[model samples]
Target: MPLTGYTIPRSPTGRSSLVPYPPWHYVGDFLVVEYWADPDKAVTVLPNGLDPHPDAGRCALVFADWQSCSDAGGELLDPSRSQYKECFVVVNALLDGEEVTTCPFIWVDRDFALTRGWLQGFPKKLGSIWVTRTFGLDSPADPGVRAGARFGATCAAYERRVAEATVTLERISETGPTHNDPPIVNVRHFARLEAGRHDEPAVHELARSRSRDRIVSPVWEGVATLSLYGAEHEEHDLLAPVRVGKGFRFTFGYTVDDQEIVKDIRS
Candidate 1:
């Protein structure tokens, strides 16, 4: 009930920064899902933040674990930490068909917001990622069922909410986009749910910090299966991925994704 009425705010490059559900797929007998990932290989501008990933040498998914499920605490604290909303639910989704099999949820956000990450102890730039997000769910350690579900899942739902299409960057070519490196995926990448677990209830967890986080509430709280509540421009600094291409405006590579409706940022 509460999840249905929520609306994504509106404003453009207006950066507030940061922000899944799926079909009958299930995880440990409960949940719903969705996520993003790289669609192609990046030759890699630098290797410090792009060291040899565990999924190296093969086509695998990449995941960004921003916070641990156990550490999520309290209602998420807003910019001022005054207002608060308890967590809603932990979700999972299935991977939509892609040019590649890479899953972005293992280590990334549904919005593709770049956060702190490392290869060794070194930092990483956001440009090095090479995957697109997909959504689905199933029992622990089991690949989620593509269609209907029976039982034994950690959490499951009846519907998978993927966008009209999966977004990808394309080179200016008559055929398609190309990259220098091969795509990789996260073999250990599994859909994790951090949600309310109830139809009309809300919950929040303590989000972990690097060094004794002084936050009164969770920064991210936990993982979620997100859908486009709709685009908004909260802070002017936040920019959409769309830009000019030749004479046509380009954002996502495919027509389906490009037409999903986004808040065009203006200067």
Candidate 2:
């Protein structure tokens, strides 16, 4: 007899996993803004093994409208299963003596995205996200072809807004890659408390993951205006912007190749 297909079990139970595979595709619009925060306050929120970068209190706020598909080829056109929006506040941190970026806070609107992010160790929550842009329909020969865009997000819980940001971009200029920026890294931690567990949590684990490129194209440079509000969650307080940096937009895709489990914090 010949095999047709394999039946794999879902994780947290069986050996099969949705990650560590290919054909994950993502198309989205991103509005990324860099800012400065208090180093002391920033350090307090990072996970056990990560530290804030010393070269100023640098951070990035990202607003994205995402259409993502995984494990299924030619399925990108279907929005019913693979459409979501995200807002993330990431800070520059040092991991194992190397400078990297770590997301301390993030919010998304879709359940599938929420589960995927949680399984990958991202502290993701539910929120509303939106992005609007103005495009000029000028002739191809016209100097100004593409106009600017705006990005906004509201982190809400129980129908109440916890955090929000409104960002506007006036113009965009394409730019080359700069080597000064650090690589993006993430710290994942998960735990569960069982009924019989008394001394500590029943399960505690920590891991690290990063994006493996499909491609990064069309880096743009521009000016932006940002207003951030963090009233509902104290964690949002660390994202207060002291100085705003240039705005940039780019498109990139990658596969979730693998992650390394660095520590097991179950005591």
Candidate 3:
């Protein structure tokens, strides 16, 4: 018997697998808040190869509602596999004199999204994420994208609230956040299960995002507030904000075709 080309739970139709092979297409609406944290605490969370950024401790908490589909486009018809909510922590870091972003923590509402993230070196966990939805209708709750409009988002894991953010739209921004333009770097690490290989990982490397066909909407900037909660088994407090910066809301789309390895240290 033969199996599928990629992913597990292979079958004749490959329907049992969680994620399919790229190119994966995603479009998402996002609410992001920028902040600065304690540089000392940040150093402990970043990976070894990454150095602290010059303007150290700069970070962003992003809340997104997304719809994704593969090249086949079959998943688009199945909402269960195509739609998800996500929240993540992005930290600025430097790798060989080049500025890049790294995600130290992330949470999603679906399993497929988690697996897809792991493949790209994102440490994604299961959590409940919610982002305020806006509409074009003329109603009190359905606020339009304009000055004075407010947006709220929250993330919770293990039945504990992890973080929350509120952004009040002040004006339309001509340019989006520049800090996020840097290529995202991630540590792709997979531990081995063999008895003798317990001390080593089967795959350990640094990879950069290779997404293409990017499209972004007009960004909205505003005043914002953020709060991070500490929990028994979680370290969300490590990146607590020292100074909260501006907030932004936008929509963007990109395609995940592949990844480029920047470092390989498999042993």
TM-score for candidate 2, residues paired by index: 0.76
**TM-score order of candidates, top first:** 3, 2, 1
Model 1 over residues 1-267: C-alpha lDDT tens digits? 122311123235423322111111111111212222221221121121123333222221112212221112221233221111111111111122122222222112222122211111111222211212223544454333232211111111123221111222222224221110123221211123546633321221111112222222111111222222112311101111122111100112100000111111111
Q: Rate the local accuracy (lDDT) of all candidates.
A: 0.20, 0.63, 0.89
TM-scores, all candidates, are 0.18, 0.76, 0.96
List, residue by residue over 194-257, the lDDT tens digit for candidate 2: 6665556544455666556567656665665555565555367666877877776665566664
lDDT score, candidate 2, position 8:
28
The most accurate candidate by lDDT is 3
Highest TM-score among the candidates is held by which one? 3
**Candidate 2, which segments miss by more than 4 Å at Cα?**
1-23, 74-77, 133-158, 161-181, 196-199, 202-205
Model 2: lDDT of residue 224 = 54
Candidate 3 at residue 211, lDDT? Answer: 87
Per model, state how many residue pairs clash. 81, 0, 0
Question: Per-residue alpha-carbon lDDT of model 3 for 1-267, expressed as tens digits?
Answer: 666745777887777777898899999999999998898887778876789899888888999999999998998888998999999988899999899998888999999999999999999999999999987887998877989999999999999999999999999987767655688998888888999878799888889989899998899999999999998878968999999999999999999988999988663
Q: Which residue pairs show backbone clashes in model 2?
A: none
